[model samples]
Target: MAEKGGIHVDSARELFPRVAEVPFDAEYKFMATFHNMTDEQGKPVVRCCVKGAPDVLIARAGYYWLPGRDPAAVTDENRKLALAENDRMAAAGERVMVVARRDFDPTTFDPKGNLLDLVQDLTLLAMVGIVDPPRAEAKDAIARCHSAGIQVRMITGDHAVTAAAIGHELGIEGQALTGAQFAAIPDEQLKPQLDQIGVVARVTPEDKIRLVTMLQQKDNIVAMTGDGVNDAPALKKADIGVAMGITGTEVSKGAAVMILTDDNFATIVKAVEYGRNIYNNLFNFVRFQMGQLVAYITCYLLAAFFFVLGGVPFAALVILFLNFLISVPVAMALGFDKPTSGLMDKKPRPLKQPLLSTSQWVRIAFLGILMAIATVYLEAIYEEAGVTTAATMGFVAFALLSISRGLSARSETETAFDRDIIHDRNQMFLYSMALLITILATELGFLQRLLGLTSLSGDQWRICIAAAIALLLVDEVIKVFLRSRLHDVKAPVT
Candidate 1:
């Protein structure tokens, strides 16, 4: 049946008839047959004859049928077909030959036309015509890798022209060099030329190893993919080695970190994306942790500074207590927040880039300043009202900072009011921890005295809550503006 771009047969009978089936035990001594047979003198002895499969055949006597053509016209059509097929196989890095049979003598047989010769010739034919095509996903995967700022280079033992054609089909960039090209260069010369070549063709096993080393010299994190025994050494040397589980040699499989079950390049792309996402999330977690540490250090240092100047009032201790108990948990919650839309679009950050960027430092500094200002304002109001009223206000401010920190932990991608953040079981656990710490600190005499003892009146407590809400709103607005202007700087792939 005709299919898109090609033909398909549902059964063998559609192409050739199965007129009879030979019995399993039937004694069969196959003969080496030839068509258009000629002796050493080159004279045709026989034109054509019908027969069963031959035990062996001459290299020049095998015939192939041309689809939609009559068998009687095979002689004329086959010559043209042979030329075309030879060119096709040659382009695909395959050797090609015609196979034919010898004329049989009933009484006298020549040893030169022996079964061994036929077998050897058939072996050569099989070797010449075989070619393995690239996987369907190779092109798309290569393209995606290019888009992601990853370079792909193809190394194959095929002839230079054939390998170059395959590289072109797979979208590999830059020039292809032969194994000889690599071997001729000294290490000194090769080290400087690695960037100019992308496809290495007609390469020996040793050449692949050297090519990998050259890329590494430039500090690239190379990923090697191989399916042969010859590929093991290079595969082992790569940062990430991939092997084809279906067709890979045992040595290659043993050397690789990952195996492609279907030998599909697309699977590798998916794996890379997953790896980047995991790393990105880990980066976010570390950043959030550092923010907490900064907050803790800043609050403690300021409190110490005030104490050294004179005796720190109980109200000041209340502010520090609230900042630590409330802010740190909220920051932890931020670690689990969903990533922004352009998370993967940004290039990977450089390995040498500082963990905290200038923007991040500025944000942390501003947060500390804002928290310090809010504490000072609450303490002043408490002092004006009376000692009892002031103590109550201090307690309220402490509680408010704790809750406000939780609200602020939501990422800039989402608002604090987003139900998802509040409902997260992990966030809930952190919030619970913060609340428990606050209550324990307030109830324990030593802790309460250490932080400056305080109990809140209902009215003063309400004022503190109002103040916390106002501070959080201002903080969120500042974050929104900053995030709007701050473009994501992608990390460089080293």
Candidate 2:
């Protein structure tokens, strides 16, 4: 029996009859070794042998072993044939390994200086090909990445044929380049071809760094994944470094920005989806908060200067209630919104794209102005009754209007009543609760006295609700107009 790193001998045990069990000797522990010999019919026969890469082992072997023939001296033609066989297996996506052995006497053997010399002039024994297929979900994950306008490339240490074969199965497009070929390309020429390289085979750590740098030169946000110490430098250089928690070296994990606990590529795709959703939710939060601030500020300024009110539209306590109890809750709910349908179908946003686009600002401005007009008009109509009554009307209307804007902010282009807004349990529940709280704040006698507010009749409440509904209707019209004209410009929302 033989045992060593990089090869599993137990799987091949069935090839030979089990005469007896033998412990692996530490003396012949090299990848290429001559472990034990047996006497069969008065001739010494080598039992267990060498194991290493086919190309490396074949070069050291001086003779070839075949069935029904004496060991024959290796010729140039024979070496070519053996190497061709290795390539054939690699092209078929199999991991090929070569076995060989050398005759030696254990009593006098001395492994000094370079122990590798012990494998010279060896007899070539056999070649093994093992199939290693990709994970079942890998192809679909890759396809999803492509749909999202993210290009996926495979950088590997396998032979070009092997890498290419695997890349094909994984849905990676473009030609595969060996590391040597990729390195040979001049910097000026390589920059343009980075996108076209689907696979870089037989890559060294340096090659990975160069590829990442070249991609960066083109303004790409590169995400590198690795599990070895040699990959640390490249992983650190990447915009987003991903390490495999299960098999990654400590150095690699330390250098990476993110770790994949399951060591699956599909998880990377899922992360991207989640990241996009968070960004969208943040955008909505900002949009809704900004629109409400614009409405409140614009209403107060217009009412104080133009209308009979001398100062601020609402009292300090009312402002506090509207901001914390109403607006803050809705904004927080918007922050946790789920990813919208067809989110992954859209292209990745450009790095230079602003958080809010021109069209989005225009939409926000329109909504703010419209809400402000409704608030000021209501205040002016009820000013004759009393200042407290007018402020109460404005307060109730503004609060309801802000909550309505939160729902419409769930989407940039879709209607406020889109399924994403109406069916979202979190947003809908919070919106309903906020609405109920607004009504209670007005009707509750203690709240009215504390906040210097007045209760509203059913008709006044209906008017406030109608104002909120009108704001949504106007927002829907703006969304439709933007959607129709957005094709002419850069639509960053998608």
Candidate 3:
């Protein structure tokens, strides 16, 4: 056994025989060991080892045994054998160590030597490059964003040429800038360049942050997408940060508001549609509620004024009941309605736009006032015929208004007659509920008495149904005119 440091070797063949030649052994035992080394500051550093079978031992020490003469011309055959044996040992989960002496001439290996010269000896391992192909749906999604008044930009660490190529493929417009170009611009100057610089390449993490800040300075709501650790900071700074979960680092995902599990650009497009739909529904419901509130307040105030003047009209109280109980339920049914055709095709409403825009307020005001006027006029005629028709006329008017309001609330882009809106199962369900409520209110004695209302006579019922049909027809007519105007405006001009 020969001992060196922590290694102990036992072999039948003598490694350093004093004679002219030494006999080779069929079997050998070899080992190499090491312990941690400490620096001058007493910090422990990693240790290493080198030892194995004679041929194995020589190779492990990074030495090539020559057939004759020089000790360096071992050829490729021996090198192949050494690598194969190492792989076999590795497959068995055995750790194998390779040791090699530094072969550089000390005089030539200067500290300031060009690193590229040393790197030239490194052959191509498998090409370690990424091919981030645009998703098939990315182009369509980009077009959709453009139509929706949203700008899409590509910010990447890839080379300018590669980034521009991808941006072109994804349909992004404007100039492409490398990191150097972006860095050369002052922060104040970057603000005006955001719209014109659509593809930013080789940008650092700080560059992304600055870009987002510059966009924010212009009051643009930026939605950024990224999948790297460096992207985390920018993701957190954007209005909406979308992370590609499939390819994103944990840091990026943690900072994002939304994660795309499939990393498909189409997902963002779908999400935008859904978000807009939710906001639209919310706005519609609120507007409808506001109209109902205004009507209720007006009725109560009028009823109080009339009572104070000693008139005390029962019809006013009836109107109040109708506004709260019947009109409100019908308007709520509009919330459950299906999305209008071309909903996604329309641009997103400006975030700064008031909740009650002029057009929306005008529609609500006109419809509510028209409904009230028509109800009162029709009831007045029924009463003028003089068959003790106070309760009956009120009931008929209330019923007509309730049903017509639903049709009036149809999308500006579509009519109540539109197949998609009319055929939605949810809308159908709401209509069924409305019908049930109306029927039950008419039949139930307590409800009828509380509201000073009554079921209609056969002839009176026919008139009420006719009035409802007329109201619906008027609602449809308004929608058709508005929809036609909208279509004309949206149509491509020759």
Candidate 4:
């Protein structure tokens, strides 16, 4: 301690070594390491001696001191001044703390290991100031979170001024209150006004649970990030708890739903981005599959009654091939499509909304009606032909309709030739593959005999092409209408 350039000015202790006593267990509360130092200025021999030092060391360890004196005396003036100075330092973006050492008149009062003897008379020691700067990436990360509509609040145990100063430096502005202020609110008033809180200081573990609960009461999808044993309860109560893997305690990690390995805020933004893309891909698959499902069921059921009321148009084996080989592959391709351009630009979807929305079902119904009408018209044209040829024509027509919807399912904002449409090349390839398999099943003799398919003539192929192109027009028109001002302005991800 002497080599560190710290001057040990033990004016009263060094001159009276016998006046010190051992630092008991309870004295550590005021950050008091030892209270056994002798005050030889007042006493002769030290009954029990310990070390006496200024409050400078204690303050550096993050503690503030409280000095007491008579009601109308000037002795405690310096301690009050020290506390005020520390508060000013705290408001200037520095952590300020204080320390003290006290001694009792062992003669006038019987001294023991009790509070009356320990806190009899106090001596102000020192105040400390510490500055811990923020990281360069922190401000940028916070800004990104704001853009993404994620609220970032700082919960700390520092003094309110200290927390506010640091928050200001980190781009977190607004009113900040201490935990005492928050807890003072009546239970009835607490919930109604909880959302306005921005920064909380001098917060306890119990305060954390209260904050999490209040935010949840406002219907927030809370994502609490914590890395301490005290943070376990809040982490568990959050909707999506994020724990710091590197700095997080075992208890906190166990309570969290996600753990950040690097403990970086920017990573969370990246996660939201990818999460939105994944959701879009999933719904894209659903929309594509559902749209075609409606069309196929409508067309096939109508054919069941009109063409093959007593018998099946396509065998069970052929239906299996159609579903597995054609529909499944297209659904998979849409499920893995790239992120759309305006995915992040839109607000988050409501948690309670159904997977396939009402609007989506309406679109599916429109496509279904069109496909059924087109199939019935084509089947009527091929009525004079044999049952096998008429059935094959209807199958080819429905296959064309499914392919049209699959490709059109790429985006609501882009057309077939839009430059961004190139991202769906894999999807287009699957469509081509599905078409090739359908043609082969119809043309091959052994497969045709096995699957009950008849090849379409040249004129029949032209009619199927016309029906497909017409249905594509219908799909595009409805998409353009939905993307207009009549409904949601955010373009749907197909």
Best by TM-score: 2
Clashes of 2: 0
Worst 10 residues of 2 by lDDT: 20-29
Candidate 1 per-residue C-alpha lDDT over 20-82 given as tens digits, one digit per residue, 9 for 90 to 100: 222211122122333334444665443222221122122233443334542232354654555
Per-model TM-score on C-alpha atoms: 0.58, 0.87, 0.67, 0.73
- How many backbone clashes are present in model 4? 13
Q: Highest lDDT, which number? A: 2
Candidate 4 ranges beyond 4 A from true positions = 1-140, 165-174, 308-313, 410-417, 424-429, 443-446, 454-463, 486-494
Q: Rank the candidates by lDDT, best first.
A: 2, 4, 3, 1
lDDT of 2 by residue, 144-234 (tens): 9999999999998777888898899889979899888998999999987877889997777889999999888888899999998878999
- Cα error, residue 158 of model 1, in Å, equals 3.7
- Alpha-carbon deviation at 280 in model 3, angstroms: 1.4
Local accuracy by lDDT, each model = 0.59, 0.83, 0.61, 0.68
**TM-score leaderboard ranking:** 2, 4, 3, 1
- Candidate 1 deviant stretches above 4 angstroms: 1-138, 186-193, 258-263, 307-332, 337-339, 357-363, 380-494
